[model samples]
Target: MEIIKINDFNNHTLSESDIIKRILSGEKELYEILLRRNNQKLYRVIRSYISNTAEIEDIMQNTYLKSYEKLYQFKHHSSYSTWLIRIGINEALARLKTKSKVLHLNTAQNLNSNSILERPDTSQLNPESKIIRKEAKQLLEKTIDSLDTKYKTVYILKEVEEMSIKDIANCLNISTANTKVRLHRAKHMLKEKLFEITTNVDIFEFGFSKCDDLTEKIMSIILKN
Candidate 1:
């Protein structure tokens, strides 16, 4: 199939309806536009669950393939990006199940609780300052990575991805109430993890300074492939 040049499709002007119509009318190349548009977001989504770089790429590819195969079944009730997120979540979950990776919900909850106590105070600094904010953001990401998959996915979706709880519920195929509960628990776990990391150990000494950077490296490697 010919790949569409997604970089050329300006985000504000790209019409999902038009893309769907094109794909349904035997323009398979149009699907690449959707893939490219959603790839970074989906990569972040999948990475929250699967830490292994190779496995994340594999799942991402599988998600797009599955989405293409099921395109005819899409009813257009939700946005195409939302539908794609659902497919990505399902693909990740299926792979996790096959690999027998335990989610360890309780562990995540515990870690979040620790984060709150460990978080550094930047209240006196200019929140608008880019350099300070960058350091603060990196600290926040480190705490996030310490969370278990269950909490990590919800937290990343709700916080990092800025998705609504309703959207997250649809992506996870869980009720909104459950999503809220998991998010609450995940937050507590992240707080706990951060608290432990900050109070008990030197982050530099532990070599965790590179945890946030690892995701970018992983993404670079995937794109290179």
Candidate 2:
């Protein structure tokens, strides 16, 4: 269960490909670095499909496991992050299909109560502004939770992950134009959904502590196999 400390690596600026090469060259611990780096992005993608925190963590583990198993198949045609995220999105969608869910949005318990949302650096702002922003973010989170699964998935991938339309289309197995269409529709839907709430907000709330725990859990599973 021992974790690799950050200071263990002398070269802190290794690229993703460099790290992947090292891991493939028998430096298994280096894999954890990638996990820690991308866990939040993967978690947010998975969370868009899954409402339950525990289930999201489980799928995150599966995503990492699958990616590791198929690492050899990853051609360096795209960035490592994009390749990793394509696997994550596919895994999340597969899990979504397994649940007995209707085409409509499925409601679940609130994940926001735990407050994993990363607060923007507000050092200069007064406490009152921070409180207002927090409330606004919570409202936006709730509204996103209410979006239909398709729209929600597209929205999270486009907005939260900041993935290109072409990448999103490739990841989702849809045409690029179709991907743009969905993204446009999702934006309009979100506007209508949040019209009453007059606060600009960010999406996706993965805490560092929770992300670290999940990364460790995923690594433990990977090491076992």
Candidate 3:
């Protein structure tokens, strides 16, 4: 089998559709490109639902394997990343149920909103800004974790991930209008003026080292089968 670097295509990365075709035709190793491309996405999506880092990693691994097994079943009705998110959410929800964390759109409401703070950003920052960003990130992470899974999931996908409202709706199997409503609710719940500032600071990041580690692990298991 010829190994093709996705970026070798005249400096243009291959589309996920093109890569998926190759993988379906026996170039299985190319799936690594897909994994590396979307690891950050899958991580944040699952992280929004569950807080245990180990369990988050576990569900992510399972989500990748599950998606691979069902890859042929994917009809491209939606973007592959969107499909994977739905699968990851299902896997996360199953774990939540197993852990008895009642899965409901309106659940986890007893907590007060006054204590909540705001969001993230991804650009390089100076030392002073970095310190302030880190502190803000910790506070925002804490605040986000306090919201109900339903609210935080949309919030992260929207504010942090910057996924389109339609994409978020598709991922969550809800209406686009409902997606907007949830985001509004999440922001209101946080009640912080720093929403845009924090996104530039990298909230819910799955860094490069972790991304590579996950890629290798998922590749090893899939290639073996």
Candidate 4:
């Protein structure tokens, strides 16, 4: 097997479809390209459902394997990223159904939620901005955790993933009206929980180290199998 560097191609130029085509055409190494590109988004989607680090890693690994196996069935009805996200979300939900215990979110500790606040310099405003951002992220995660699973899933898909209402409905196997209602309720709950906060900051980021590690592991498995 020949190793290919996806970065050799203009990273800004090749779309997901282009890479998928190449992978299907026998450039299997490019699958690592796809994994590296979408790792963070998929991790965030899965992280929204469960909090166990080991479980999250397992689900992500399975997600890649399942997606590759079903690649032939994927029609171009949705963007490739959306299709991948649906696969990841569904896999996480399936694992949740099989387990009886509820998992906790990473909470403030693992999030390093106080790092920004710990360092305060009057001359530097960036630290203040970072602190605000960190606090907002913590608040957002707390608010999301407070929501019921249905609302939380819908909220994350719509708000965090920026997925369309119809797409979310389809992905979750629910009606559009139901999706809308759930979204509305979710927003209301978030508003009630986050009345004091005003800025948007993304939470549940997959760290760079973990992203690279997972990508390497997935690539190794793909090559081995």
Every candidate's CA RMSD: 11.4, 13.9, 14.6, 14.6
- Which lDDT values do the candidates have, in the order given? 0.74, 0.74, 0.78, 0.72
Q: In angstroms, what RMSD does candidate 4 have relative to the true structure?
A: 14.6
Q: What digit string (tens of lDDT, one per residue) describes model 1 on residues 70-143?
A: 88898787777789888888888888787666653332322222222133565665534544455566677666
In model 2, what is the error at residue 176, expressed in angstroms? 1.3
Q: Which segments of candidate 4 are over 4 A away from where they belong?
A: 1-12, 101-124, 196-225
Residue 114, candidate 4: alpha-carbon lDDT: 21
lDDT of 2 by residue, 1-225 (tens): 334568745444777787887778788888888887788777777777777888888888998998888887878877777788778878777777766475554555656453334545848767556666776777778788778767777788788777888877777778989988888888898898787554434332543344556788999999999
Best by lDDT: 3
lDDT of 4 by residue, 47-124 (tens): 777766677789999999998988778787877767887888888888977774665533342542222112234455
The 10-residue segment with the lowest total lDDT in model 4:
111-120
What lDDT score is found at residue 122 in candidate 1? Answer: 54
Using TM-score as the measure, the top candidate is: 2
Instruction: Write the number of the candidate with greater lDDT, choosing between 2 and 4.
Output: 2
Error of 3 at 185 (Å): 1.0
Error of 2 at 122 (Å): 4.1
Model 2: runs farther than 4 Å from truth? 1-12, 101-106, 114-119, 196-225
